[model samples]
Target: MLNRKFGYVFLLALLASSAAVGAEYKGPLDVPAKVNTKFAQSNRLTAVAKAGNALVAVGPRGHILVSENSGQSWEQVPVPVSSDLVAVRFVNATHGWAVGHDGVVLHTADAGKSWVKQLDGKQAAAVAEKSFKKAVAEGSEQAKKSQDLVTRFVEEGADKPFLDVLFLNEKEGFVVGAFNNAFRTQDGGKTWEPLFWQIDNPQSYHLYALATHAGELYAAGERGLLLHWDRQRQYFSAITSPYQGSFFGLLDTGKELIAYGLRGNVYATADGAKTWRKIDTPAPDSVVGGALLGAHYALVTVGGRILLNKSDGSGFDVIPASSPMQYASVAAASDHSLVAAGARGVRVETIRDQAIQEK
Candidate 1:
């Protein structure tokens, strides 16, 4: 569940571990990722999505799980890489893409039943290096720094991770990740253009979430990094954020735009980014998962508590899970149910009959 919330913490941990390596390992990029026979469905999953009537979840070890009967039973789907998958998006019932560590991007034509690797860190770094070098040669100051960044990417091998992905349809899509790594594909997964230079991310902050609000695309990430699609320029422009902390998830409840992140910080804007007001939570724990439950917004914290807010932003409540499982991502499976994935695997929660217990 590498939504905006979990991607930052997970990527930081991954970077910390990879930093211990003395040098980059440029091994075979085409090698198939390993598949564990057992515990595939029970493994820690980062994100979940609804594909028609089916539920798809992805996580560490390139694991992808699908459950046609909601979250009750899941079957593992074979993947081509060993990278940790963080985020997944399904445009319709069948077409979708999954992104993960090592800058890995995978595509599925038949929903989550089968997949093919579209791109990975090996090719991503190469593409970036070439593009940045070209920019440097043209005397672009930004390119000079971009070259250094991509050079480090090459040195780090496939350690980088793509935190989030979004597809406009079966063909047009985008994948975003740490250090301003973003790519766009107009011809399905056949080709991708490096978008690192297009956005207003001068600091190269990690782009954690890619979403659509009011029929417009938006991205949010580290240090209050917020961006909205500029259709005319074919780029994402920076949006003014009310909070300076990292935002982990973006939710559009039709009536309002919500950006939530570290330390239970939730801000809402009904007039796009022109105005924002804080929707205070009960605790300081990070909000790792969220969904639009009917007329309210339900946000799940990493501390295993679910926070609920009214559409008018007038009421708030907290409901603790029965177990202490650290939830990562959640999706509205139905009008009354939510499917969440995280440290304890995937679970279906019934919210209709649950009483609102304010904290």
Candidate 2:
């Protein structure tokens, strides 16, 4: 996981040098990911998702661990690629996808038991370069950037990573990542097409998070980059951001929209991105992850602080943790508590009205 005191991509790339950006990437699809039985579950995990009743977490070295009983114990599963997996999503218990470094995407048919490579950076780079070559003839600022990307792909073969993924169902989904990377797979991973050119990202900044509310999809990223999918138009349009800093993650509480990132900056949009109101935060640390607990929402910061806010427009209050340690992601446990994992491994805590049962 990218550990940022203040959120951004390049700094994360530097910290994850061993697994990220490779000049000699052998095309992740060509190189099958290896499984190290000894270190599978022990490696750093980035994200976790609930597959029906089972909880699955993915991380560095292609580590995927599945726990059937609310993270009490875990079992490592075999994955095809060794590229670091950052985000995972499941439309149903039996259908899911995992995306990671090298733009690798994996699909599973049997919950989290096994996975197959669906797309990789090498193929994505080829497709992107093909599209860029056409733009190169137009001779504009975007064209120049496209041409440069083509040259980079020719030399590097698509080593960029997909940081987060969203699957609305078995057939429709989107995967987003660094450097304006986004793709759509409508046929259940049978095929994927690049959607970078369709969005209004003239600067081509990194896209960090994807969220959907009331059938509306929104993407958040660097330098206040925001995109909203126009179902009627069949494309994502860039929306003006309330803040100019990078946004690391986004959430839709079915009542309000929250875009969070650098320096504990967060905003809420009840009427979509048309207008936004900044949520008064309790700390200055970056918001790393979030979870919906009933009518309340929990936001976890980089320094392991938990902030609680109501979905019905209440001010945020800091929920103290047992220990002040870094946490990368947050999920609601089956026991009605919250499960957070990061630098100090997994920690489960009971959140009351304003107090917490530290564990």
Write down the TM-score for model 1: 0.86
Badly placed stretches (over 4 Å) of model 1 are 1-38, 133-145, 354-359
Residue pair clashes in candidate 1: 1-46, 1-47, 4-248, 5-248
Error of 1 at 33 (Å): 4.8
Give candidate 2 misplaced runs (Cα > 4 Å).
1-38, 130-151, 353-359
Against the reference, the lDDT scores of all candidates come to 0.82, 0.79
Candidate 2: C-alpha lDDT: 0.79
Residue by residue across 1-359, what tens digits does model 1's lDDT show? 54986889889988887876635553434455566534876768899988888889998878888888867788888887767889998999998899998889999989799999999988887887777777778887655656666677778877788999999888899999998889899999898778776788888898889888787899999999999889998778999889999999888888888888999998888876888889878958998777877766688888887777754477467754555478899887777678888897887887645553321
Q: Which candidate has the highest lDDT of all? A: 1
**Highest TM-score: which candidate?**
1
